[model samples]
Target: MRKNRNLIVLNIIVILGALVMVFPFLWAFITSISPGAGLSSTPQLIPDNPSLSAYVQLFDRLPFGKIVLNSLGLAVLTTGFQLITSSLAAYVFSRMPFRGRNVVFAVYLATMMLPMQVLVVPLFVEMKTLGLIDSYLGVLLPSIASAFGVFLLRQAMNSVPTELDQAATLDGAGHFRIFGLIVLPLVRPALATLTVFSFLNSWNSFLWPLIILRTPEMKTLPVALAGLQGQFTTQWDVVMAGSVISILPMLALYIFTQKYIIQGVAGTGLK
Candidate 1:
């Protein structure tokens, strides 16, 4: 009976926590639909007169479709490149035997500690030298290799049994063949988690794109959303609408791959 009471109390606390977490998003959506809704001290979850006027006005004021397409393209390309590069690097770090392997991996892991701000000037200079400044490549080149992704994937790969590799070797399979046919399939959950993470990071990235992309056409959603704020006055409803639209892809992606993310994260152990 004591255990049951504790469980009930825990359940109630969890339910309330869930509500608290969801309330802000609910308020944002309500504000988006409530035409001319200003920032309120007490936010309403339900608008008395809900409408899509803010959403309509948002598109009218900004080329949101093109911006969305640009963000989507950059995100897709960044995730694709990171997946390839991270998987190959992770495979090497986890599976290969070499002198100074541990030291090299440690050095690579240390790079993740460096803040991106510190590298911006040097990266920009390199892009300028290559004439990639103000282009998608400029925004993308730095993101193609992800240290976090490598660490996560390497951890996942470590969980895979070496016996499988030996069996594949006995079957005359090379390292590349084992990687493609044996290892990748075993780490599908980790790959899915990485894909979601890479997509989210690329989609929401602001500073790098702001520095690298010069034209309005190349602007990403976050930078474009920031533009909605005026020097003097801002439209809260329109900003809220843009916020709603911006979160949709991430929400959909999280809902689809949340299981994999949970599984992958739980299974991975730092080695």
Candidate 2:
């Protein structure tokens, strides 16, 4: 009876937390589906007419399909690159022998403490000097060397049993082959976690893309969404529509990855 009561309380708390977290998305959702321009007056929880006008207008005003493709491409590229670079770095830091490896790893980990804004100016100047200011490569370059991913993957790799590495090496496999066949498969959940993180970070990137992408064709969804906030007025309904679409991909990705992401953390076993 006491356990049942605790479970009931926990359920209530969870439900309340869910509602609190979903409030903004719910508000934006209702606003997007509502027919008229403004959602301020007597905004019911559900849409009155429930028209798709805002979403239609959102696409009409912007090339949404193109933007979605651009966002997907950028996110996939960034996530893919981060997985390779970070995993290699993690593998080397975890298992490989090298002079000053610990110190180098320390420096790499230390980079995570530096907020990205501190390096933005230098990065921007570097891109400008390379004539890549408005290019996709320019937007992606800064994010490729992900310190957080390296740290996370390194910790995950550390948790892996070294016996597996020895077994692979005994099979006449090279260090790279051992990593590819043994370590990577074992840490798939961790990779999934990092993949989702990298994808979301790249997809929702605003300030860097804003500075780098000058042209409409080059603009990402987040930067394009920023234009909805006009100088004198804001287009709430249409902006919300764009926002909903922008977030949908991330939501879907998260849903797919949540189990693996959870398992990944639990796999660390230091909890």
Candidate 3:
């Protein structure tokens, strides 16, 4: 009976926590459907007469389609490149032995500690020197590789039994064959997790894209949505509408990959 009561209390707490986390998104959606809603308006769980005029105005004011495409393209490219690079690097770190390998990987992992803000100036200058400023390539080149991806994949790869590699080697299989046929197939969950994370990072990326993509047509969703605000006045409805739209892809992706995310994190021994 005591245990049952504790479980009930825990269930109630979990429900309350979920509501707390979901309230902001619920309010955003309500505001998005509430025409003429502003920042100063009273919060309402349900609008009196909900309309999608804010959504209509969102597209009218911004090149939203192009912005969405830009974000989507960058995110896809970033995820793809990061997967390839990080996987290859992780395989090397996990399977291959070399002098100073651990030191090199440690240094690489340490780079993750340096915030993007610190690297922004140097990256911008490098982009400028390469004549890549205001170009998608400039935005993409910096995110093509991720240290966290490398670490996560490496950990997953490390957990794989080495006897498989040895057995494949005895069968005259090369490193590439072993990687593709044996190891890669086993780490699908980690790959999915990385894909989701990389896509999310690139999709919500604001600073680098904002700096590299100067033209209005090249702006990503986050930066373009940010422009909805004026210096002194802001339209909450249209902004909320844009926010809701921006969140849909990520929400859908998480829903789809929720199982893989949990499994991947668990498999990797990550907290």
Candidate 4:
């Protein structure tokens, strides 16, 4: 009976936590439908007359579709490139032993300690020198390789048993074949986890895109959304509408990869 009571309490706590996390998205959705509502106005769980005027205004006033496409394109490219580069590097670090490999990897991992803020000026100068300013390539070049992704995938790869690689070798499988057929399949959960993280990072990127993209048409969703705010009187409803829209892709991606994410976290020994 006591165990049953404990389970009930745990369930209640979980439900309450879920609600707390969900409240902001719920409020954003509500505010998006509440036309002309400002953040200063009293909070209304349910507005008197909910309409999509804010979304309508957003689309009419801004090139929201193009902005969303730009974000999606950049995010997809960044995630794909990161996955490829990180996976290859992870494989090398985990399987291929070489002189000074550990030292090199340590140095690479140390780059993660340096925040993007510190790299911005140097990256901008480099982009300018390369004449890639205001181009998609400039925005993309910096994000193609991710130290975090390499670390995560390398951890996952290390967890794979080396016996399998040896057996594949006995079967006349080359390093390329073994890596492709054996290791890659086993670490799928980690790959999915990396994919989600890479996509999220690229999607929400503001600083780099803000600095590189000069034309309004080239601006991604986050940068474009920032333009909506006025100096004195901001439109809360429209801002909320954009926020809701920006969230849908990420929410969908998470929902689709939820199982893999859990498995990946557990497999990697991460809390």
**What tens digits encode model 2's per-residue C-alpha lDDT throughout 213-264?**
8889778999889887889777788898998898889999999999989988
After the best TM-score superposition of candidate 4, give how far the Cα of residue 199 lies from its true spot, in angstroms: 0.3
lDDT digits (tens) for residues 1-271 of candidate 1: 9999999999999999999998888888988998878886467767788999999999999899999999999999999999999999999999998999999999999999999899999999999999998899989999999999999999999999999999999999999999999999999889998999999999999999999998998899999999999898888899999999999999999999999988888878533
What TM-score, to 2 decimals, does candidate 4 have? 0.98
Model 3 residue pairs with clashes? none
Q: In model 4, what lDDT does residue 110 have?
A: 100
Model 4 Cα displacement at 80 (Å)? 0.3
Candidate 2 Cα misplacement greater than 4 A, ranges: 37-42, 269-271
RMSD of each: 1.4, 1.6, 0.8, 0.9
* Deviation from truth (RMSD, Å), model 3: 0.8
Off by over 4 Å in 1: none
Regions more than 4 Å wrong, model 4? none
lDDT of each: 0.93, 0.88, 0.95, 0.96
Q: Write the per-residue lDDT of candidate 4 for residues 1-271, one digit (tens) a residue.
A: 9999999999999999999999989888989999888877776898999999999999999999999999999999999999999999999999999999999999999999999999999999999999999999999999999999999999999999999999999999998998899999999999999999999999999999999999999999999999999999888899999999999999999999999999999998877
Per-candidate TM-score against the hidden true structure: 0.97, 0.95, 0.98, 0.98
Candidate with more favorable, higher lDDT: 1 or 3:
3
Count clashing pairs, candidate 2.
0
Candidate order by TM-score, decreasing, is 3, 4, 1, 2
